[model samples]
Target: MSSTPANPPTALHEVWLIRHGETQWSLSGQHTGSTDIALTDHGRAQARALAPRLATQSFDAVWSSPMARAIETCELAGLGGQRVIVQDLHEWDYGIYEGRTTPEIRASVPGWSVWDSPVPKGESLLQIQARAEAVVARLLAASGRVAIFSHAHFLRALAGCWMGGAAALGAHLYLDTASISLLGFDHESRAIRRWNS
Candidate 1:
């Protein structure tokens, strides 16, 4: 039998990660998780602005968090028909911290930080990291470019995982509402192509 040559490596695909538009709680700096809040009027406008930019790209698949804000943002961005709701893309579960601002949490628990402190009765950092990893794995297994619409904290965690870092690293990445980010491999090494765009 003749020897066969190894197959060439597949080219890396990009994943477009978009943070959902602003909500009443997000505008107020509240920790919104599992609250099912809707986007504000300004948020709708912001999402609409993304339509032109997103229209230029051809995504093989589009995923979104089950939250209304994320779904609404996807719709306003003109990608509604392509969206497939993914539970793993949902925001962090805030539990007792839901709807509470950082200042308020600090007032009750001095020097408390979501990244540094434990969230009482909420999802742990490990859990968030696991979810992010799963989403990344699924996207990598798929063909062509992918788009994901989700929340700030969760998307930050996903970005961290994409860069082969722990979820805590997400604290260093700040994501604003209605923001668009890109994650792709650079010559076989994972990289953040763009952030907070």
Candidate 2:
């Protein structure tokens, strides 16, 4: 079988990885993935604040998940024209717990950590890594800074994958809604410039 390609060899181009803003589920600490939910009213405000923060930076490409929460974020952040929808950027598929929280899942399976426990029919760590790998491969074929609008877990996993870390390392990174992260190369290697703020 053909293996998935690694990230490109082009000089480190700035990558802006953004997590979408507040959603009812997000505020409640629920696992959000594959659920087409919209952002709260405040979420829109948070996304708009990004406009000024990004206005000065020129992005070669902008990609977002087809999910409303992510797509809306790009629109609110003033990146609609440059945005492209990529399925590989979609959030983790929560499966049985599509809209549930960790605490709730733990009730049945004590100490159930997503990193330690399976998502009960959702994407496995390696599966999610494959998705992340595809997106990185797409970026590698080009040479310019890119902005990715996506969700928490997926973006975190991408960061881990980008750094040659295991997919489970995604659990170590944290992200807030509308939060911007930087990823680029350091000298001769690809590295995460900064994790979630």
- lDDT to native, each model: 0.87, 0.85
Best by lDDT: 1
Candidate 1 lDDT score relative to the true structure: 0.87
Per residue, candidate 2 scores C-alpha lDDT tens digits across 1-197 of: 11222444354378899999899999999888877889999999999999998899999899999999999999999998999999899999988988889889889889987775787789888898888877777776756789999999999888877777466778888998999999877755777887775
TM-score of 2: 0.93
The list of candidate 1 runs beyond 4 A from truth reads 1-11
Candidate 1, 73: how far from true, in Å? Answer: 0.5
Error of 1 at 176 (Å): 1.2
lDDT of candidate 2 at residue 59, scale 0 to 100: 90
Shift of residue 187 alpha carbon in model 1, Å: 0.9
TM-score of 1: 0.93
